[model samples]
Target: MSRPRPRARLTVLAAALLVGCTGSQPLPSTSTPAPVAADAVQDTNPQPRERLRDGGLLRFPLAALPTQWNPRHPDADADARRVLDPLTPEHLALDAAGRATPNPDFVTDVAVSHEGHTVVTLTLNPEAVWGDAAPLTAEDWVATWRASTGQVEGVAPVGPLGWDRVTDVRAGASAYEVVVTYAGVDPDWAQPLVPGPLRASTVASADAFAWASHRDAHYAAPFLVAHVDQAQGLVTLERNPLWWGDRPKLDTIMFRTVQAEAVAAAFQHNELDVWETGTSVDRLQQSRAAADTTLRTAPGTHGRSLHVSRAGLLADAALRRAVLMAIDRAEVGASDLADLHEPPRTWSSNLLLPTQPGYVDQARATGLANDPVRAAEALDAAGWVEGPGSRSKDGQRLLLTFRTPIGDDLAQGEFEVLAGQLAAVGVRLRAVTGEADLTPVSVPVDAFPLARLPEDVASVPAAAELVARVASEVDPVRRADQASQLARLAWQEVVEIPLYQEPQFVAVRNGLANLGAPGYATTDWEDVGWTS
Candidate 1:
């Protein structure tokens, strides 16, 4: 018989956060290029090789390099985190199926014991050592845990989620075995172990958040930061001589900064070997123009959606449900990428990506079909009398203000169409551009109603808590169920309307091998090589 999954009962409302991006070579073009078919050619996943090459240089692109390479530091930006990922040894890896797989180079096994409290044991490979020839022991583990959990004062960790619950860290049978006891159940024992020993020394410093050095202070993987030129926005990673695993297939990997707007140009100019952010239609067109480029496409993890506010006349639960029913989610997503090619990017679920396992169609399950008739009926039953342009109740008009990220034309267009859909059902949506602020106080504006109260921030507590729970759950089956539950709640409660998830596209030179879709995971430095 299987043990029953431990359930944590808690309630908290918050917003979901997502982060990340993705690459190729081509001849320079001087004249205006004709538009190419988006899907002119199909590409396949690169197959593994029976035998790999020993040395080559792979040129990659980064939007920018973080001032510091520390992943655990609070000040480390997204760019820094991207460049720092592969250089830091990974203790655990999430496979394509999202199951945690132990990295054989670092950890031999990971086991959790729950006896009143949760205890996690990490059995490291005795042969594992840092790039500096330092044997990774219990000290590194202890320091990393302490710094992340705030057990040490003056150190600001990135976040105190799983680490905060850790009660003790001690050496097990040997220095290579780490025993960590938590004050409460921590189902996510693998996540915090990724950076492993790479963060220990920097995290021990009092000013860890702002800590910067002329060079990498430590390294754990097969690559070491050999050079960083901030002025030119370049970072070069050289093969670590002290690597204990198989020697890397590449001699060096270079990350150069290229603005998002300049990516297509960079690829067409043959300045970058891999265009890591080639998702948009224009980007695909540019890659298609490059004869030697191979595009790798996958279902992306990040999503584009709208967060509705509960201020003004939208405080009623029935109205919230009505707005969800009235708006055509498919149409909204369609309008988002209308200018692009056919077959919308990919519809999204509030919980898991479509590519993930155990995903259920909660939008359909919760009866959120884009039917305006049912929506009007829901509002009518809720005592919102129909009026010109919008419905009203108690002398208050059914007016909603929406805010999307600034400078996003696609999102703006999506809201514009949604506003019309809602207007047809007697709900007026004011699509605006700015940050979403929920504070009641109003800031002065240069328009009518110079000062109006801010929209009330709205969130589904059950949905948010379920997401948190899903992250911590260890069992794959149970985690999937929890994820489905979260999605169901979000759709049912109309927490937020998930529009679509962008299909990830990575353009790379045809010669490059063994690199998966960008952002899927760190590149296998030991396996990535050139065919030539």
Candidate 2:
């Protein structure tokens, strides 16, 4: 099963082309050996390529083409953005744990002046320029800020971060220096600017945003679009001649749209250089079994939680609490694993992922784990009496309409197993297909500072108040304390039971380095090469 776009405190933050193949041929599938586990932590950091030669073709797969090449556009395609974001743009800094450091490739230095309104001065690399030879100067940054904020008519930002608090963005001492003056000291000011800048021309009007494409596009990164055969669902990128940085190792990189089910087969056949096997049990088996394939695993940064709708029978906190206690999150996660190498790890806190800092064991603190006796007590106290194969409160039957995305086999299995578990506890879980409620899932979070959190947790008022405290308080220890309090509040109310941080399994062919399971760190495109 493909992993859902993970819910991260920070937004989840992908290349190239050239002289490899003149024509595309349908890739033939081949078979290989049993998959096993890798020895190292799953990472996308540059690997040693000292024994490797330069210039080879790297092929991979994306699920689909992005509807729009402009990732900022409301209709931008997710798969396309996944590849385009890192390959064609420059950011002031790369996303990492703790404070994000300036990207020496794009930025020379960043300084802050707190004397008055929060003023930030960013110095751009003098040699950095767009593919079209236009200097990527402070003006481009200012244009991006203006276009993103909707200050430029017909343009709107991707989200409302701290940009509304901005007072001005002006050229500093030179064209390469951008001085931003905020209306207040906003801790999350760095959140919105990470996508780097839309070229000055692209941000000039609404029409220009739609002018970019996967086949022919302007780029500032180490790679540029070399070929795009949409009919064959293939995109190829080659080294960018205008790139000011070190030359990238591979001459070409290709992205072909491969269905989720077909990924394991494709990788086993040697059609792909790497596979991003996201929480798929079958894929895990296949990856482990593949001869010469190295498997990388890591603690996930995203949370897999049960999103309960307030309009359902679970509206009552007691009923929701009962359901949480009835289900064994460990079992549910293990079922998803189904004999995979790593055993499932139950999520303890809603606010922090297992790998992050400030994580507290709120699940234990709230005692929301599997306990049918406690579940029965909560149900009974809520006036739900046990009946034939189900429970009843007043005239209503304890039937909940559970939903998961269509075509998700793992979700289907999870729901089926959960239904049986709930049924054993006098509750009826009706597995139904419904549209995802994106409103509750898209809460913006900055990973490093933990500056902001979701406004509410459905009906939990205390959670909302606690999250507000987490957002405002400047002290890290105090923020962690407030976060723990809020997590405990959510758990007590059964706002959501985060099942497990889904493990990401990645398989890379031997000799390929600097590429694998991309985590928070931006891939250094130039460093991706092969070992001899």
Candidate 3:
């Protein structure tokens, strides 16, 4: 499951702790001149677009590159694929479309053991080779486990949930098997192994695998540690000359950081081949309609939410419920200029199109309905009596602070709308435009006084686990139940109201081919091909 980055927490805290201490600066406009849609010479079967030719340069904008290049590491960022591609990479590597499927660029086949907790076998492409020409092998898997689990020294913790279950990881002739034995029978054991990668041979030895249970510095991916060029803000991955499958189309894949708006503008100017940030939906739609370029929109598993602070009267469930009812999600979505997002019913559901699997619709149906009448009544029942055109309880006025990212225009607009809605219910809603600080009152789970988050599903599981763990009673079943329950509640409470699914948009030159969208596990480099 996708997890939120630690930076997001810091961002929230920074907003709260430093509010009014600093002045808000408007983000520079990176809007681009609208491009004429690239001409589409009718291809009858639109399912498969022609592959791009080799040697073609694909330049795309990135917001930030990861300090760690390895995908298996806990701290790996979404952009890590630019440097290291995982074995059995998921289709549409960066985007979550469905269950991860094999990418032709990496592993050949993945086999799961029948017992469900024992073995997961991955057969690497016989031709697979690292950028440095070392054959990809079983040793890599062993190393990966050691590093991610903190079995080695001098490595950072892979955060809270380190890899501590696997009993053994061994490599066979052409296949590598990771035999995992959890503390107990975990039905979710299949998860950790599906996207397994070979550990770097340079760092830990086979014997180190036995020490995987120890939390040490072996948590960092060696490939990333060795190959990343931090000064240049670039990660260059040279083709594995010995790669078993067809050699990767690009000689070297370079991931570079650029401003989000600049990336959009670059796509319009044809300076970049792909741009992932979803900034201007109207411009993209208009451009595609005119045939300047192919515009493909897919629902993403990301979202945005308005955090409610539990300070003062908001600590009351009735007040929290009232706040939820006062805001109109549909209206906020309507006012959004970029149709890249939609009103999210629950934080558990994917923020983008057609809700996620196992998502329940009760949050939208009953919990957070835009009903001022019900909201006011709930407030009254909770001792918040409306008096002289205001709400109060025991002589204390009902007041709340809504915190959002300071410089984020999109969130600012959305929160402003929410503030106006809450005002009609005799509630004093103050819009605090700054960093989110939750340290003062030990931040309430249901109502965080501060909220700032990226729109990715990777973080969803963590949020869910936090919520479930807080309420869990049984120690043995605490984590599992917490995870599942959090996943369920993400949809149930609409904890983080998602606005839309954002897509990475790339603008390729006319002659480029073999460009398809990358899935959640794969990178853009996988789908790209350069035509003659």
What is candidate 3's CA lDDT for residue 197? 57
Cα misplacement distance, residue 136 of candidate 2 (Å):
1.2
Per-residue lDDT over 25-50 for candidate 1, one digit per residue giving the tens place of the 0 to 100 score: 11123321222111212233444544
Query: Candidate 1: lDDT of 96?
Result: 39
The numbered model that scores best in TM-score is: 2
- Ranking, TM-score, top scorer first: 2, 1, 3
What TM-score does candidate 1 get on C-alpha atoms? 0.78
- Angstrom error of the Cα, residue 194, model 1: value is 3.2
lDDT of 3 by residue, 381-400 (tens): 88887876578888887766
The stretch of ten residues in a row with the least summed lDDT in candidate 1 is 14-23
lDDT (10s digit) by residue, model 2, range 270-372: 8898887776666777888888778876654465667766555766777878888898878887887776666656776656665455667776787777898
Q: Least lDDT summed over 10 consecutive residues: which range in candidate 3?
A: 440-449
Give stretches of model 2 more than 4 Å off. Answer: 1-41, 49-52, 62-67, 89-99, 113-117, 157-165, 212-217, 229-234, 257-266, 285-290, 311-313, 394-396, 404-408, 434-452, 463-465
Q: Give residue 155's error in model 1 in angstroms.
A: 1.9
Q: Against the true structure, what is each candidate's TM-score? A: 0.78, 0.80, 0.63
